[model samples]
Target chain A: MDLSGLFAQVLNGLQYGLLLFLISSGLTLIFGVMGVINLAHGSMFMIGAYLAYVIASLTGALWLALPLAVLGGLAMGAALEAGLFRRFYKREHLDQVLLTFALILLFEEARSAMLGNDFHAVPVPAILDFSVPVTAEFAYSAYRLAVLVVCLFVALLMFLGIERTRIGSAVRAAAEKPEMVDLLGLDARRIHLLVFAVGTALAMLAGALAAPLQSVYPNMGESFLIICFVVVVVGGVGSIAGAFWAALLIGLVDTLGKAYLPEIAGLVVYLLMAGVLLWRPSGLFAPGR
Target chain B: MTPPILEARGLQAGYGEGLVLRGVDIAVRPGEAIGLMGRNGMGKTTLIRTLLGQLPARAGQVLADGRDITREATFRRAQRGIAVVPEGRGVFASLSVMENLLLAARPDADGRTPWPLERVLTTFPRLAQRARNRGDQLSGGEQQMLAIGRALMTNPRLLILDEATEGLAPLLRDEIWRTIRTIREAGLACIVVDKTVGAVLSVVDRAEILVKGSLVWSGRPDALRADPELMHRHLGV
Candidate 1:
């Protein structure tokens, strides 16, 4: 690959990883704090794309669609936690799997009924349509750069929110010992609700942001779902920072692998996961001493 | 007699068909210290769990400050100024000493900040030195102190300490017992469950004994000491 091509691929890897982090950060938290395996996380992303597509088409603007998608995700997450995930927190993993899997079908059917199973595309906001002149002959796509900036901004906000605030500490505390949180009289339900809602909104936001990059279609959530689980496991079951770095590493490996070693691309990310597990079974940033 | 700030009447609870607390009843008046004593599997912890609303009372009621709180959630009970430094220390292992203390810090019901972070850190100067260390990094004695300090941060009117000094060295255990005495002296109502019979007797105003999930005895600590046969029969200490 040429110098510019390598740089573009590296950027592509970072962008892809950031997007994965947006989604996997939620996945790890929902699993870590709430102890609920949210198999439908990718569906949040898929729904975001569909929401983006619908909104962009209706209002002819992606910006308005973004906030609406976020709002929709938050409400959706809150509703799901209250109605479904709340009850399943203590249930066996088999039951949780059944519940979330049912949700995937429900979402897919609803998507088909509401938007039809047709492939759709969201137009990039006209403002970000141009490229930055990195080199005279080679430049970076402004849209991809914008996605990277937005993802990083969100990541920074999440870092500050989870690390610097009282609620953030409580969430971290809950992730370690939920019953203890309740014993402290901190209302574990509210914490769970907050974590779930935020997780859902994040996944959806990732999807909404990615809609222009990757066209939307039926079961689009399924494609990202397994990879997200990988990210969650490799990052550590409940560590957000772990998920962040792990997602980036996976993204670079997957993107660069496909770019450079096409035939073995599919095998590399899993190999990385295997390697990480072999080295640190709990995860890269496991919670304890 | 003063009305109990916390009370459990006929608390019948257990795990999945095996009853642990069979018709157990206990109460703690304002600023009263209680030693809930028993051997292993005698439902001492179960009774505490039921009072805190972590375990449901199958056929009884829990009242807080004379109000029925049987149906209240655990956090709601905490909002009412009930806090437990549960068994196993229950510290947030991944969180720093400061974070764990600050996470649950709040003004009491009447908008009082009696147990702020500064006061708590002062109380446990050992904790002050290790404010940035994670909970798991603390020694057993330090973890127990952190748990108590964290509970104090809530400005709880009533604090429960299950296994307050379960697995500490003799010196650390002495340190915890001193702290517990200090907490009781600071005018906080407390429920302490510990295997150290002599230590428990020294601190609590009243001693309540459980045997096979029933409150078989309750009286002054001296009264408990007078009945060695009773202690040998129930406590096995």
Candidate 2:
């Protein structure tokens, strides 16, 4: 490919990677720390996109929809945790998987019943609707670039929140030894709830941002969910840094693979994951704890 | 002497379908040191689990400061000043040493004294040296120290250490013993379980010997130590 075409693909990869990181980081955190494999995590992403679409449609303003989408995602995560996840905390992983899988079906059906099956698009704020010149004859959408920047900012904030604060320390402690966290007189259940909520909120934010770039259909997050799992698996189960780096690598591989892998005529993103797993069975950065 | 700070009466508990403790009774007076003695599979660990409410007691009552605590959640029991340095040290492997200590800090019942981070560091200098190290990084002895310090951070009225020094080197075992003595001197009641019967006997006010899933013998440390044959028969070397 030409230099400008390659540059555009790189940017696309970065944007896609950043969004995947936002969604998968939460999934990995919950999985690593709580050991709960929540199948409904993707539903949270879909709900975010739907909420953003609804809010943007009603208010005709993208900015007005973002917070609503995030809050809605948080509420949904908290409700699911309180009502179902809490009950399964002590249950086996198999049971948790079954229950959350059921939740995914329920959430998808509920979304269809409430919002209908029609595809929707969130309005890219007029400020970001313009295109920016990348090369003499090439241009990239300002909206996609803005989504990349916003996701990067969120990732930075999340990193800081996990690394620099007392709550972050508690979260790490809880993740490592929940029994110890409880013995320390801190309610581990509360920390689990907080992490789940935050993770869901991030997923929602990703969904909301992606709404402008793609159709906000009921099944929109289903595809992204599979991609997010690939991100989680490639990164490592519990390592945020792993998720970030892996997401970027996967994004690049996926974007470039779709564009360039046709020449080889057989390999795909799944092939790339298979290659990574062959080398590091636990993903590139397995959680040290 | 003050009706014992903690007491477990007629306790029976076990994992699903397989009972490990049967009608075990143990008590710890405020500022007193009690040693729990038993061979492997003799219900010492099970009794500790029952006392902490981690394993439900099939039958019995647990009391702390004269209040029935059998039905209280493990966290609730902890809030009432019962801290356990569980077997295997139970340190949060992912958290730094400082974070583990801080997680257990709670205000005293009268709200007079709190177990601050600095106090814990002072008590366990090894932990201070490795403050930033993750829980899993510490050696066995240091992990045990962290476990004790983690328990102390809650300012518990009664502290229970199950298998406190099972896998430590000789020097580290001596250090742990010194620390336990220091804690006892500070007026904190302790329930210590260890294989070193001679060492624990020298430190504790009383000792309870268990066989199978029941308390087989109970008396002053001197009484048990005087009978080496009795120790060998029940403890099996």
Which predicted model would earn the best TM-score?
Answer: 1
lDDT of 2 at B85: 90
Per residue, candidate 2 scores C-alpha lDDT tens digits across B1-237 of 467677889988898899888888888887888989989888888888788778888998998887898987787878878889988989877678887777667776777455677878888999999999988788999999999998988888888988898899999999999998888888888888988888888889999998989888999999987898998899775
Top-DockQ structure, candidate number: 1
Q: What's the residue-level lDDT of B95 in candidate 1?
A: 85
| Predicted complex 1: CAPRI docking category | medium
DockQ per candidate: 0.78, 0.59
Model 1 residue runs over 4 Å out of place are: A275-279
Assess candidate 2 and give its TM-score to the true structure: 0.94
Q: List, residue by residue over B1-62, the lDDT tens digit for candidate 1.
A: 76788998888998888888889778899999999988999898888888888888898889
